[model samples]
Target: MATLAAECDRFKIDVIGISEVRWNGTGEFTNQKGGVLMYSGMPDEQDPHIRGVAVYVRKNVKHSILCWKAISERIIVVRFRAKKFNMSLVQCYAPTEDSPLDQKEVFYSALERTLSEIPRTDVIILMSDFNAEITQSIELGSLFPHKTCHKVTWKSPAGNFESQIDHICISKRWSKVLCDVRNKRSADIDSDHYLVVAELKFNIPKHRYEHPQHTRRTYNTTKLNVGAVKNEMIERINNVSLMEDASIEETWLHIKTNLEEICKDTLGYRKNEQKEWLSANSWELIAQRRSLSRQIKKAVKSDKRNYYVELSMKAQAASEKGDMKELFKLTKQLGGISFQSSAPIENENGQLVFAKNEQAEVWKRHFEKTLNIIHNESGELTIPRHLNPNRQIDTRAPSVNEIRGVIISMKSGKAP
Candidate 1:
């Protein structure tokens, strides 16, 4: 978790979808480095940790997490409340091609159900280690396979077989946000599967408040703690007129203008961070591979083609040799675990609400009626025989040890 968080920080990645985590049980935890890691796996203690899924979100993105559901060992989902719309990320590990047809069908059915739960307006990104080539089936459009030069994601130990099993799919509604998707073979993740990433362009909407839209302005309130800033703010506030006869609108306008001015002059504005994870060596190797691939695609002479293939095989072997402790830790954390549970709710009319929106409304109404209902029959109110309004409360300051002990009592790995 620490190594992955460091990599994400270096890459400036907001969120990463992961599969084949092989963990046992579902959990949300903050790693030692502060990034959020949420995972879902089998609940049974005896089951092997062969399949699991997770999402590692950077601190900035972690605050936006709305909810997460562990559907099964094969699937896990995390939903983020984005500015413009909700973003649903689904990570999956599907049955291998050699597995029974019924198992494959069951996995596909679960995946479909998961996808169906997401609202049409939300942005959906489906990432999976499918273990088989994908075909155009549902509205989720395949992105990486069609864009990369060497589309294969996995290579055999003998270097005799190459197949593309891992894939990324985006909702048809969000197809325009996709800039590109490619297989990063040079990524040294110490896995048989290469890293497949999709470049997306999303403009998060500004936060809206109850104030008049035209009169409102966003500010960096974080600077208020600086001594100089605080002094400046005090001076500015002191200089504002505050006559007793002043109209409410006039007073509000003055306050608003002062805040905007201070924010503009002192706190400044925020800038968007860019994401670019490739290291120098990785780029160089990728360029060489791409050129060789293009040359081969052009049907060059047999000798030249053979040379290109040999070089490509050597490069693939070198990539396979890279060691990543984090990858191994992920697998170990996933070893031997299984669990399962589900809940289905009914609507106000006693009919099941299959649609998400309807189900939400049904629950809202149920809670409102259940919690707010007033009883027609009344019961006698009893008061305590003895009461004291002037009871003294403890006012002594806490010692350093006492404060430390209180802090130590707080649970680690739990969300704030």
Candidate 2:
């Protein structure tokens, strides 16, 4: 099973069906490389692994698996959700030609009923190692007409006979999805039957969270303490047109424009930070593991096989329980295990702003109003002792440190 999974990984197969996997009982287990393997065997504990069928789906695509069932020792059905439509994958191992007709009939009957049970609207892909030759006139007929250089699947042990017994059939509704199906004779898996690969063209849906896009701005607040930058910002703000009788909106716009221009010239902009959890060393180890796995499959001598096995184990161990750096990389590779919904925000009017643009605009108004407030209503007020008494509040120019501290105290990367 491990070797089979390694081959699947080597071939980059999204999903594969296995036949005659003489395992005892029906169950699912995770392979070393994280692929999902579901198999069905004899119902009784006393029975052996004969005629067992299984399906191995790659880790990346396993999340789309809706459900799976082990119908019998010879058949197992798995269903998956795709972008445009649902899909049902049926895998089976049919009785051999030498088997009794009644047994063959029972297998066919079960297979037919299984196919019938799947939703007619969903795309169906039926893959099986049917010991009966499809080339025989009484079988699937022209549905799988042979082409040159690929007339047979199973070769006799004596290298004398060959026949096309394995088959992959799709529902007529999804016939257009079939890109190509061919027998890969070069894949020598030590079995008389060659590997049959089928490629189907269908889009896989990418699930995403509907989160509001934030208009986060990054400012070089740390640069405000520089004497030259501080002086320049002050000079620019002092030159702004007050338009004494201008409406509140006009004055507000002028102040906003001047501040933005000065900040842009002095502070500059902040860049978006990219999250990198995976390290380079972890990726290299992964590549080495895959390479060693392929070599193990081809190694004939016991010593060479053992050498490859040890190397592969080292790679796997380095990936699993190695340094935090490598473990983080592996964790990043297995992404989206957790789901987090977007946080809600309150707008200027105390109403929630969930829409992307609306939220951004509301935040802008909020900061502008907050920063421009001259005095807080709850704070101590400077009032004249009498109606005629005059009062003046003394003010001093802010030092570079004070100016920089004010900017630093504000949200690090937030913009008004």
Tens digits of per-residue lDDT, candidate 2, 34-96, equal 689999999987985488999999887888899999999999999999987999999999998
Cα lDDT tens digits for candidate 1, 283-330: 677557656755764665676667656655555555577534443544
Which predicted model would earn the best lDDT? 2
Q: What is the lDDT of residue 95 in candidate 1?
A: 96
For every model shown, what is its TM-score relative to the native structure?
A: 0.48, 0.48
Model 1, total clashes: 9
Alpha carbon lDDT of residue 317, candidate 2? 77
